[model samples]
Target: MLRIDGKKVYLVPFEEKHLVDPAYYAWLTDFEVVRYIGRDEYLKPIQFEKVREYVEELWRNRYCSFFAMHHSGDDAFIGTAKINYLNEAGFSTRTADIGIMIGDRGYWGKGMATDALFAICNYAFNDLSARKLTAGAVSANKAVIRAFQKIGFLEEGRLRKKLLISGEYMDHVLLGCFREELHPVI
Candidate 1:
């Protein structure tokens, strides 16, 4: 199993055992937890089998690496993170997209997300040989945007009124960080 350790948390490869956990499904269904993710699938009642199939599909994708985040001290599951290569067939492009979701409400507002980002960024740059990593957030999500910026991700671009959150149209902020700009905290 692949495990990436950070200051406050560690990430393990997301596995079938995670899908069996009720809390994992609850986090995906929680509006406040996933609202910024901009996926309408969370708004409806989701079946366990469908979620299982979705995770299975993700596992089948060779370019995507999914991880389940856990608190270091207590080993409590806190969230999920992923790195997806943008290349179609080969990894020569060395560009990828990174995303994280702190599903446990108790962990919100802490620096865990930043730590997770640092660990993932380090893995991408050092282990995966990624040249650049990109991430996106709703403009209204200042906290998430700040986390990315805190980790040296610069504003790359924005899509105006791209995400509809709580009936309000919000711009999607794009951010990117080159491998050289990353400050590894793990």
Candidate 2:
């Protein structure tokens, strides 16, 4: 897909050039940004090289399709969303996991995430022919969970204490949305 344009944000194919901005590297170590997503310990010094290597892998990996989320009006890079572990075309390859991160602090709690999630999910089910999409969020991350639900993902199960945050064990909510569950987005 060239791009998935949402009401407020546009999801473009992730490219190496997207990393040129200093904010992209800085968000990797921001405590508040990575908190419930795990990696809170990234409090250590930020290394641009290591971050580049990670994004490079995503760029080259066939099983992953990552997108740089940009605000529609100004085209400002806001964050990223991804579909990982995409199985090759076949009757059996009908499910994938979705992940997202709105690294821009200024955009937090502004519904941009919800918009991006819906756009990617549309691409997954409509374009990719994915039968089901799954996502996991720490139960403490209510915002992520709510976004998933807003996009039609239903709570399927829970992984108890699957995540350790702030020295406390937290449950992980498992969510899944099937093709039939999604409203056709034209």
Candidate 3:
């Protein structure tokens, strides 16, 4: 179990307790935030149930990990971050991908994402032997791109028409960072 903490934020292992909250459903239903992450519709209880089922499967893996982000003020849960694709084959053994979301729109532009990324990556590299990380952003989202860049991820390339969001195809911006070259801004 990986635990990273700060004055206002902390990251903990994703658990069944985290999903028991009703706010998660509200966050998953928020169109502005879910526009880039979820399918066209809002995620219902059954949907999150499925997510829980899938996550439990992930927890049984050798390297698979995910965290539930929480705040210190209200102790309110904000979002989640996941490090999947934990295979031992090839160079993957040294690398782990990252994905995050701040479910509370009220916390937007407050550097919570930045804080969470820094804490998560620090734990990943030093604690989990993670050497590299990557994240993707759909064209409809500029905040995700900016957040990734703030963490020192450079624009590797764009995957054309990779997502169908808001009823049309959208492009994907691939961003990455490595242990040898972690971006300071991150």
Candidate 4:
């Protein structure tokens, strides 16, 4: 459970203990927080224990590397980020899918997501030997799309009406970044 230190937030390996705070479930149940998240079940309120068990299970999963995003200054829990290895049978495969969520409403629009994304990109490309990474955002999730772009992910394509949010279909913006495409931040 090593920590990846970044400018605004640092990523720590996900632990079951992280869910001790009821706020984690609170954020998951928040409409605005889960609005852009792809899961349809997340749209409805979820019980705290259910979400906790899900997170705990994630920690035990080998294909996914999850981290708790914490604000640097105050050590506040802001959200979580993860990179899922796409081809489990092929250990040599270097492709993965990246995802992030700034569940804390107060951190939205504060550039924290960009920082977290950068940290994960570095961890994936540099540490984990990932050759390429991919991610998708609901087209309406402008902030997340911008964060991915800001961190050097290029627009790969779009999936039309890929996600159903609030009974309406929204296009999913596909993005990707290669190890060679990453530009070192000054």
Candidate 5:
């Protein structure tokens, strides 16, 4: 589990203990928020038992870093972030992929993603011994694309028709951030 504080928020691994939180599940399964998450969309709100089982499976996989984004004021679970897709092909152990979602629509556009990203970068470099991080954003998601840029991820390339959303193909923007390249004014 990775713990990050300050920036008025924190991120830690989501455990089975959190799955039973109805509020968390309700927020996550909210279609309004999940519209832009990934390759597939969840058809129905997940059952607590299913979510718990997923947490258990992920805990065992060790391929994903799923965190519960929390607000410091009340320690409330607001969203999530993940770092996965570790590549072992090269001699250098320097890069991984990142993904995040702010489940609480009420908390959107509040620098929550920025803060969470900074913490993730810190984890990548400090704890995971990584040198770089990568991510892909849907072409139409200006907020997310800009968020990645705000965190020092430069636009790398574009993949046309990479994803099908609502029966239409959408492009993807590949972006990256390097550990040695981040500059934090603290």
Candidate 6:
């Protein structure tokens, strides 16, 4: 099991047990939890079997890595993070996309996302030899955007009125960070 430790949290390979956990499923279906995820408007609540299959497939995909985030002090499962190569050519491009979701409501607003982002970014830059990392969030999700920015991510661009959430259009904020800009917390 791969594990990356940070000041407030640790990330381990997302596994079968995580997928089957009731909390995991609940987080996915909760509108409040995933409103910024930007799933197409026509999409319905996620199905269990489909998520299982997708996770299983991810396990074999060399270009993507998914991790389950846990609180370091109590070992509480709190969220998930992923690093995906931007091209099929893999490391040749030296670029990747990083995303994270803090699932447990109790962990929100406590810097858990920032800690996890630092750890994941360190892994991407050092372990994976990635030169640049990118991320995006719905403009209204200020917390997420701040977390990324706090970790040295710079605003890259924005897609104006690109996402429809709760019957309102919102901009999609794009961010990017070079390896040198990352401040590792792990």
Model 5 stretches with alpha carbons more than 4 Å out: 39-50, 90-92
Ranking by TM-score: 1, 4, 6, 2, 5, 3
lDDT (Cα, tens digit) per residue for candidate 1, span 1-186: 789999999999998788788889999889888888866787678887888888898899889899999999999999999898945743668888999999999999879999999998899888998888999899988888888888899999999998888899999999999977887543
Q: Model 4, range 1-186, lDDT digits (tens) per residue?
A: 599998999999877667876667778888999888886677876777778777777777777888889999999998999988845742367888899989899988888988889889999988888888999899999989888888788999998997778889999899999987765444
Best by TM-score: 1
Please estimate how well model 6 matches the true structure, expressed as its whole-model Cα lDDT: 0.88
lDDT of 6 by residue, 1-186 (tens): 689998999999998889998998888877777888765521467688877877787788888999999999999888899999946765688888898999899999999999999999999999988988999899999999989999899999999998888889999999999988887433
TM-score of 5: 0.87
Give one digit per residue, the lDDT tens place, for model 3 in 1-186. 657885467989888787778787677767787778744545333477665666677778766788899986787899988776557652355767788999998888988887788778777777877777877889778887787788677788898998877678999888888876665461
- Collision count for each candidate, in order: 0, 0, 1, 0, 0, 0
lDDT of all predictions: 0.88, 0.84, 0.77, 0.85, 0.75, 0.88
Candidate 5's displacement at residue 19, Å, is 1.7
Model 4 earns a TM-score of 0.93
Task: Give the per-residue lDDT of model 2 (tens digit) for 1-186.
Answer: 598988999999987678888878878878888887655546567678877877888888887889999999899898999987655652366778999999999999998888899989989888877788999899988999988888788999999998888888999899999877765234
The TM-score values for the models, in the order shown, are 0.95, 0.91, 0.86, 0.93, 0.87, 0.93
Residue range 1-186, candidate 5, lDDT tens digits: 457774868988887556667767786678777667773535455666776676676676555677788987878888878777444532165677888888888889888887788788778778877777888888887888877787678999999989787678999889988877665524
Give per-model CA RMSD. Answer: 1.7, 2.6, 2.6, 1.6, 2.4, 2.0
Question: Which one wins by lDDT: 3 or 6?
Answer: 6
